[model samples]
Target chain A: MRLYLAYFKIKFLNEIQYKVAALAGIATQFAWGFMYIMLFTTFINNSDTNAISSSQIVTYIWLQQAFYMLFAFWSVDKDIFDSISSGNLAYELTKPVNLYDIWFIKTLALKVGKTVLRALPIFLICMLPFLGEFTMTAPVSIMAAVWFVITMFFSTILILSYIMIIYILTITAISPLGVKITFSLMGDFFSGGLIPIPLMPDIVQTILKYTPFYYIQNIPYNIYNGYISGNLEIIKIVGIQVFWIVILIALGKLLMKNSMKKVVIQGG
Target chain B: MIELKNITKTYRVRKRSAGMKNAFKTFFKKDYEVIKALDDISFEINEGEMVGYIGPNGAGKSTTIKIMAGILTPDSGQANISGLIPWKQRTKYVKDIGVVFGNRSGLWWDVPVDDSFELLKNIYKIPDDVYKQQKTKLVKLLDIGEIIKIPTRQLSLGQRMRCEIASAFLHKPKIVFLDEPTIGLDAVSKIAVREFIKKINKEDKTTIILTTHDTQDIEALTNRIILIGKGKILLDGKLSDLKKKFSKKYLTVEFNGDIDQLCDGLIFIEKYKGRIIIELNENILTLAKAIAFLTSKIEILDLEVDNTSVDDIVVKLYQEYGI
Candidate 1:
């Protein structure tokens, strides 16, 4: 655990070197959080809407932006694959450490540290104006906060599993230009990175629930919106999230083992 | 200790024809040609032997190094090092070996060289006392004490190469594989690297397997040479033996004053102010008859002869092997 935190802190210091970029990153998160506020506001004003109350919308947007740190995924593959193909892999391989874990966890720490450091502060800044609006029971608010944290944690695992699968596949495929372009496009529409799914097209909204993306954002978004309700609904969402996490991880392991066979053949 | 028996590796490489149309076609069709990288090669290095692994381009030098380093598995062979199969016991086996690829910089680009060393220490799980002591020794030997505190990105290639060698050795592994370690280095840097390598090999008896196109490196380091060509070990013996086996019938000729005549196998290879020197094959003509002819024809300045250096033999080997 000490080593893990050391790696995290080292990465944090590395990323903090770009102070202006870090500042801009936080500013961007809040600027975009306000856009979602306008969006949900436009939706709530459509009628005396109980589907999503105005305060719940604000809560949902706040969680979506605040705990956004939970869903970030990073992989060691991009660096590892490039180095392997370019003959630089020899250096890392000659070392005494597990090369895979070294890169994998370091990148994970980088993405998580950057996101939390950027996302939480901006989320709090954006939510500061609406603190006067909420008058909820402390226990209920605490439960909601705990559930949102759990949602973020499990969702991150699912997303990381997906990234791991892509990384393993990249060994055989070479040059993950296709994956990079796809992820860049995915960021534009899905994962609440750019826009919330509920306000998207009917087909997109339906697809989001099936994907791990919504758990990363929209599920937590729903929790704060109070759209999630009843003991049974909570059980189902949590159960499904856990199920996907297990399934994704198993699938990632299977691919990783299969890729190990190819690593023997291709020597990547 | 390292043992490799009949190790072989083959790589399937895509073959593309001329024209953008064919290149586009290969994107889908993917034509491939198999290349035999290592062909039934066998060798054993005892614990302390410093051997030079020499070859021409595409001669499987790097492949062999990678296999020994645990980064590659041979297609078919048995290789066991210190009771561990390299590719099978990768993590464990790699801990016992250090590799330096001359072309690549392993140091973090933006971080100080010492930071990279510290990271390496953590990576290898070296005890703090040993790490500090080794770092001090390496810094003193390589003369990179100042540069180690500076970011690697700002260092010159020679300085960075020094750091690279030091980094690989800090762990004090039993075996070190240096692939073209002296490549592109200046004369001073080359001598410094050679001296350091000699020191480590002598002081610690670390098994050093070096691959280089530079014959000077071979002469200065390994007395035993393993020559590979076309993915096969064609010759393995002492460097002097190789030279003796390749050359026969030395030539001696003394030219009177400066008379320029172009003749096959008669080389104007060496010259002095009062004399002209040439090596003529006694197999082609007797040295006594030639000397008699030369002395009778004109005034003889002076002439003596000696065997060619190791460089000429290597060039001849390449020509004969036609790699």
Candidate 2:
């Protein structure tokens, strides 16, 4: 809708104003990327099971860092959270608009806006060949690159849908802190932000596949690193990503509708 | 046209005492107290009418506004605004109404005020020509043409409030609910806001319901006022009628001779050499009779007559109602 586009533009423009925050975020991502690489190398070097190759690990870590914000499960729009908690939602309700749709677009714009500022620098820096073993490699094939792009787009929406569910959950709770913390911790570990899925034990990866988190960062980054390949297999994974996106969004909308009926703005 | 019948709202709030021990104990048991925010209350407003909604703090003024604005639903009520139920058909009903809360902002804090207006235009689906006309009129009336170019956070409170008023009217809704629109404003800004409100309500035939503790706002803007206290509608009548009911006249006279006793309706407040301040109850003693008595008693050199202000009337009303 045109209204949602306008909201997106306003939210995106608002987000890009924090230039210092973007710079600080880039530095933190680099530090985290290097630390993750260092820890992963020791585990891969000591093992001989060949669960994941060294080159795949390096590329996966770099890609995750480049698009860190896009896939981050803990990154919720604080404005939306505050609106729910502080009774400012009364103003939002006065508008002739659906609360869920506006918030979805706002979260999407915030993630895309922040990722735009930080992703490019990390991508350009990590592509440099002089970094030796730490350098990030390109996609294994042109088809893999295409699949990576497609999956990344779905994954972003997928995660945003999941975040909306958390938002609805927060609305039902007395405080947002508990929901945010519980989801942040659970999503971080399950979405493979804590560790690459291929590097984890086989049974854990099998268990994660049953949940939507397995399809989030795990599928896209692995596809880029050539860990999950072949046309049929990649197509199957993309299909599953679409499936989860539909499911999470439906679940979120249902919850939002139910919660809205009982929603009470406590004080003016 | 707006109407409410038997509207009631009750809020369940968790009860807890102070200190860690009581807090811990209540956390487990979780006792809740139901507060009747709005009792069985009803009122109606005709088109193009400006009504002042006055009450003490926590008197359900905001709750009634929220219910009518579609931000809240009452526990039991039937409210029809423009032939639409506010809570049942919120998305459709809200299209005809606007709301402004004085202490809170509806604008995007980091963006230019124009951007927020643009978004509102899109959200309300206002036609291009209509939006432009509304914007130009509001900007000129509120004197926010230059202020709209700046980001909202950069503007002063007065400037931001002007823009806020402008944004709410950009769509030209049929009704506008203003909760303390003149609060914390300087004299000039307050007058400008009041003038703009009056102009809009008159020109567009837009119904306006204003709630404020500022008696001057009520006195200057609205003729009809609905007074609520303790979740009940205590008084609903014309402002002039309430003024007549609680009216008192203060007469200060500087005279040559004033050594005299007061009448039954006349109470002497202050007496100095050749000067006297008397409280005249207009209900019992007319202003003309009080003046006649005073002139007869002394050769009045100078006289000053003052009426009881709206503030005093409100305090008296509250005390009378024991709220």
Highest DockQ model number:
2
TM-score for chain B of each model, two decimals? 0.86, 0.96
Give a tens-digit lDDT track for model 1, residues A61-110. Answer: 66655555445443233555576466576677677565445655666765
Candidate 1 wrong stretches, greater than 4 Å: A1-6, A47-49, A62-78, A130-140, A183-190, A198-210, A221-242, A264-268, B246-275, B280-307
Residues A1-268 of candidate 2 have per-residue lDDT tens digits of: 8999999999999999999999999999999999999889878988886878887899999889888888887787998888888788889999999988888999999999999999999999999999898999999899989999899989888899999988999986878999998987899899999888887788998999889999998888888889999999989988998999999989999998888878888665
Flag regions of model 2 displaced more than 4 Å: B262-265, B283-286
**Which residue pairs in candidate 2 have backbone atoms (N, alpha carbon, C) closer than 3 angstroms, thus clashing?**
none
Q: What is the interface RMSD of each candidate, in Å?
A: 3.7, 1.1
How many clashes (backbone N, Cα, C below 3 Å) per candidate? Answer: 1, 0
Please provide TM-scores, in order, for all candidate models, with all chains considered together: 0.85, 0.97
CA lDDT, every model vs. true structure: 0.73, 0.91
